[model samples]
Target: MPDQIADPSDLRGDCAQCFGLCCVALPFARSTDFALDKPAGKPCPNLRGDHRCGIHADLREKGFTGCTVYDCFGAGQKVSQVTFGGQDWRTGTKEHARQMLDVFPVVRQLHELLWYLNEALGLSAARPVHADLRRALERTERLTRQTPQELAALDVAAHRQEVNVLLLRTSELARAGVAGKGGKGGKGGGKDRRGADLIGARLKGADLRGASLRGAYLIGADLTGADLRGADLIGADLRGADLTDADLTGAFFLTQPQLTAARGSAGTKLPESVTRPVHWTAGS
Candidate 1:
C-alpha cells in the first residue's frame, strides 16, 4: 500500500507524466462522482488535448468532487516516458493508444495498492511486518514502472493477488493490537461513536472492513485504496470523502444518498445495479 502522507509536491495536481487518463479511461455518470456522463475510453469533455483537466481550477464547484481526490502515484509519468515512449493518446499511433488504454486501468490498480502499501510500512502499530511491508512496497513500485508492453501484457489480477497477500499480512500486523480479546477495539468500543470526528483523516489503504462507523463524520477523508469491504457506514457523513480505488463491495448501508453526500472519484467502485450517483452534474 502507498502512504497517505503524500508529499505536497507529489499530489495529483502536480503530476505531469500522466496524460489525464483518469478523466478519460474511467466512466462517469451525471452524478456525485462526475459533472457529466462519460463512457469509458472516451475523452472527458473537460479533458484537454494537452492531458490536463480543462476545469482543474474549479472542479469542486463544477461537480467534480471525485476528481479532487484522485492520485496516480506517478504511474502516469512512467507510462508516458518508459512505456509508451512519450506518446499522448491523442496523437499516438492506434496501437500506442490501445496500449495506453489497456494499461491505464492496470496501472491505476497497482498505484492504488502502492499507495496503501507505503502507508502500511509507516504505521507504528504494524511494526511486526514493517520490513516486509517496505519490501513489498518496493516490489510494487517496480511493477508500476514497467513499460507499456510489459504493463499491457501483464496479468494484473495475478499481480493484485500477490500484492494482496502482503497487504493482508500488513493489515493483520497493524490491527493486531486493536483485535485482541477484551483489548482496545472490542464490540463494545466499536459501537461508541462519540467524538469520532475523523474529517479529512488520511485513512488511505486502511482496513476498516466490518467496522461499525455509524454516525461517523468522514468528510474529506482520503480513503483511496482502503479495504472497506463489509463495513457499516450507516448515518456516516461522507461528504468529500475520497473513495477512489477503494473497495466497498460488501459495505452495508452505503446508500445513494450517502454517496451523493460524499464524493467519489471515477476510480471508486460500487456494488452492481446502483448507477453512479446523480450529484456530479454541471451545477451540482
Candidate 2:
C-alpha cells in the first residue's frame, strides 16, 4: 500500500480550474430547484465567456437553487485539465465539445466513488478493510484518467456497485463499535433504515445513531434536532429536508451536496467531513 493517501481536497470542486462543465453538461427542469428549463449539453444562460457563473453568488436568490447544491466532486477540473489537457470547450469543434460533455458525467460518477472510498479508508474501525478500500480507490482513480471515448463506454453503474460492497462492509465495521447507543427516541443504535421511504416523515428529534440510511428518500422530511451520529448517509436524498439543530457529528458517507440541500441552523452539529451550508445561517 502507498505510504500517502490521496488528498481529500482533490475530490472537491474547484471551479476556477474548470471550464464550467457542470454549467454546460447538466440538465435541469423549471421546478422549485431551478429557475428555468435547461437541456443537457447546452450551456446555461448564466455561464460567462470565461466559463464562470454570472449569477453564482446569487444562485439561490435567482431561483437557481439546484445550481447552488450541485457538486461534481472535483470532476470538472479533472476533466478539463487532466482529461482534456486544459482545452477550452468554447474553442473546440462541436463534436469535440460534445465528447467532453459526454465524458464529464462519467468521470463525475467515478470521482464520487473515490470520495466515498477515501472516506472509508480514514475510518479507524474500518482498518480491517483499508487495503480493500485502497485498491478500490486506486482502481477508481485510474478509471477517471481514461480517455473520453473509454469513459463514455465505461459501465460506471457496475463499477459503483462493486465499490459499494466495500463501503457497506466499512460502514458495518465502523458502526458496530457504536451499536446499542440509543438515540433521542431511545431506539437502539445501528438502525436499519436502508432505502426507506422517509419523505415528509415526522422524524423531528428522532434518534438515528449508527443508522444505515443508504438510498433513503428523505425529501421534505422533518429531521429537526434529530440525532444522527455515526449514520451512513450515502445516496440518501435530503432535498428540502429540515435539519435544524440536528446532531450529525461523526456521521459517515454524508456528502456536501446532501447537506447543502437540507435546511439547517448554526445550532446543528456536523461531522468534520462536511462543512455547514452557508444558506443554513444566511439570515441569522
Candidate 3:
C-alpha cells in the first residue's frame, strides 16, 4: 500500500481560490432552483464586487438553494489561475469575459471526470484498471490546464463518453462483491431504473446495495434509512430524496449536485467525494 495520502486538489472545489465564475457565467432560470432568471454571461444579482455571494449565508432560506449545492470541481480556480492567469472578469475586457465564460463549462466537465477517476482509484476491486484510470486522470488534468482557446474548443462530450466506459467497468467490479450478501441489488426484479420517474416512491429502508441508479429520477422519494452501499448513482436525480439515515458508504459517482438536492440528515453515510449538505440536520 502507498504511504501517501489520496487527497487530490483538482477533485475538490476551493471556492476561496475561485473568481466566482459560477456566480457570473452560468445562467439560471426562475424555477425551484433559483429565485430569479439570469441569462448567460450576466452576473447574479446577489454577487458582490469581490466575487463573493452577498447572500451566501441565506441561499436556501431565500430560495436560491440550487446555488448552495453547486460544485465546479475547482474549475473556477483552474480557469482563474491557469487559463486566464488569475485575471478577474471585472477587470477584463468584453472579449475576455466572453472567453472566460465559454471556457468555464468545458474545464468543469474535465474536472468532473478527474473527480470520478480519483474515486475509481480508491476502489480495491477496480485495481485491474487502476493504471488506465490514472492515465485518464492525468490526460484529463492536462486538458484542464490548457489555454482558454484550447479548452473552449475541446470535444468534451466525446471525452466524457470515453471516461464513462471506465467508470462503468469500475462499478461492475465493485458491485460484484454484493452477489449474495443479503443485498437485493441487481436482483429481485430490481430492474435497471436508469432515469426512471421514481419521484416520491415509497422505498424507505429498501435493500438496494450495489443497485444501479444511474440517471434515475428519485426526486422526493421516501428512501429514509435505505442501504445504498456500493450503488452506482452517477447522474441520478437525488433532489429531495429522503435519505435521513441511508447508508451510502460505497455509493459510486454520487456528485455534490445530487446530494445537495436531496435532504439527508447527519446520519446519512456519504463517500469522501462529497460533503454533507448543511441543511441536513435532526428531523430534516
The candidate that achieves the highest lDDT relative to the unseen native structure: 2
In model 3, which runs have C-alpha deviations exceeding 4 angstroms? 1-7, 179-191
Q: In every candidate, how many clashes are there?
A: 19, 0, 1
Whole-model Cα lDDT of every candidate shown, in order? 0.64, 0.88, 0.83
lDDT of 2 at 122: 80
lDDT for model 2: 0.88
Per-residue error (Å), model 1, residue 90? 1.8
Q: Sort all candidates by lDDT, best to worst.
A: 2, 3, 1
Q: What TM-score does model 1 achieve against the real structure?
A: 0.60
Give one digit per residue, the lDDT tens place, for model 3 in 9-32: 666678777788999889999999
Overall local distance difference test of candidate 3:
0.83
Best by TM-score: 2
Q: For candidate 1, which ten residues in a row score worst on lDDT?
A: 180-189
Q: Please, what are the lDDT tens digits per residue for candidate 1 over residues 122-198?
A: 55555776777677777766777777778877788987777766655554444343321223343322233323799
